[model samples]
Target: MIKITYKMKSYRENLKDIIQPDDTIIELGCHVGKSSQFMLNRIPNGNLIALDNSPEAKSKMDKLSFEYKNLSFLNSDVRLHESLKKVKEKIDKCDILSVDLGGGYHPDTTFKVYYIWSSTFKPRDSIIRNRGLIDFINTATSNEDMHSENGFLDSCGDMGIPPQIKEFKLWSEKI
Candidate 1:
């Protein structure tokens, strides 16, 4: 077993709490498979669909694929609607969904992809990076802020998903 740092150790433990042995998981922005490896360790009989736009990340994931039979890597831009749609088609549903697109910018593209893809499966549990979560909640809740925030939220509103937000502390430590 790999020894994770304290922060990651707690995050992994939180994930393990929500993830079942046979639950399917879809992770967006799976850079070099750090989280993927942790998730793979938990789901022995389940499946993991990891997506990333970086060729280097894909290369690393490709190597890890040989070691993990339950993992599948999709080398594509998660911000693209077409790419997300394609993934949604492949795995109709999953028990857990994790999003960590990094950069802390492009909330529009990030939430757009997340909203669209999440609508397909509607996983019971979703873990999003703090910035993404804040952006999503802010846009979803207040209409006035929606106009000023970004066009993606307006677009999401047009799709008709109600603004029902719930907050929770899933992990004790920040990653």
Candidate 2:
């Protein structure tokens, strides 16, 4: 298992650039609140909604919540459409949607969950695990005809993501 310190270091080095002070952030798969805590430190005036299905994850975040008043934990399976809908209704808009569902989830399921949760918010930056899903989405959304034979690109194309969505990398390196 990857230690939480490594995850926190990865976020600090690679993903910290995208976050702003007052941005409303929603993190999917807050395992042990490690990543959430990293994001919390940056968002002083901002609020975070951390979601995870594991009871242990919830318990860990519950303990950390006392230290950070702006952080909130929601114990729910982010892959579920109902849970995504409920979360979308609660937040007016999300500035950043950080997704790290861990290695248990297949890349396709991760992309599907990201797509579902992303639709609720208007054009915002996102940091996703560099599990080929980001590369696939970037290639699919761009007009450049690269990686045509890639399986992930084919899958995103099948999902009907238009070529108009802007493509950018939020993290410099994979965590």
Candidate 3:
């Protein structure tokens, strides 16, 4: 099965740059730890906590955790503030917080109504949505292009998402 997720680009503030070896990294929707591995490289001595509430996802995380001594897995929902707060205490400030809420979205929201789910095309068989959420502070609009065959880009970016977030991107100045 193909997935349609928020796309994230590595930047200055990204885990690879900002997170020191001693710094702890927190990532949401870690899934199978695809990008998690990238962040791990930046922190040699640090521990990475991948947050995902799904049992299958968590089990996947468990499998990955054994490989990396510096890696830890957590099975908890995003809305579970109690658990998240506990994590926050250990890691005071986040050098990078990956907001990737892709898996387990119940297929689609109101936006999916407009999305073409099924047709002469075979949906995921025909197309795959590769998106990674990025940081867009104090913004009301952003621009992005949909897939080649698909130009209809209904981005959540407009609802306060970043245009492009990659390779050491940073915004210390208050919006």
Model 2, position 43, has a per-residue lDDT of 93
Model 2, position 114: C-alpha lDDT score: 67
What are the lDDT figures for the candidates, one per model?
Answer: 0.65, 0.65, 0.46
Model 2 lDDT tens row, 13-53: 55577778998888888889887988999999998999999
lDDT of 1 by residue, 1-175 (tens): 1111124455566677777789898988889999899899889999999999886797899988999999989998865545656666777677777777763645665555556556555666766553544655566754453232321233444343333321111111111
Give the residue spans of candidate 3 off by over 4 A.
1-17, 103-175
Q: What is the lDDT of candidate 3?
A: 0.46
TM-score of 1: 0.68
Best by TM-score: 2
Taking the tens digit of each residue's C-alpha lDDT, what string does model 3 give over 1-175? 1223333453223334445676565665676777777777777887777777766686667877887888877787644434455565555444334445552334332123212211101221111222211112222365854442322233332232132321112111211
* Candidate 1 Cα outliers beyond 4 Å, as residue runs: 1-13, 103-106, 135-175
Q: Mind sharing the TM-score for model 2?
A: 0.69
RMSD in angstroms between candidate 3 and the native structure over all alpha carbons? 14.0
What's the best-to-worst order under TM-score?
A: 2, 1, 3
What does the lDDT come to for candidate 1? 0.65
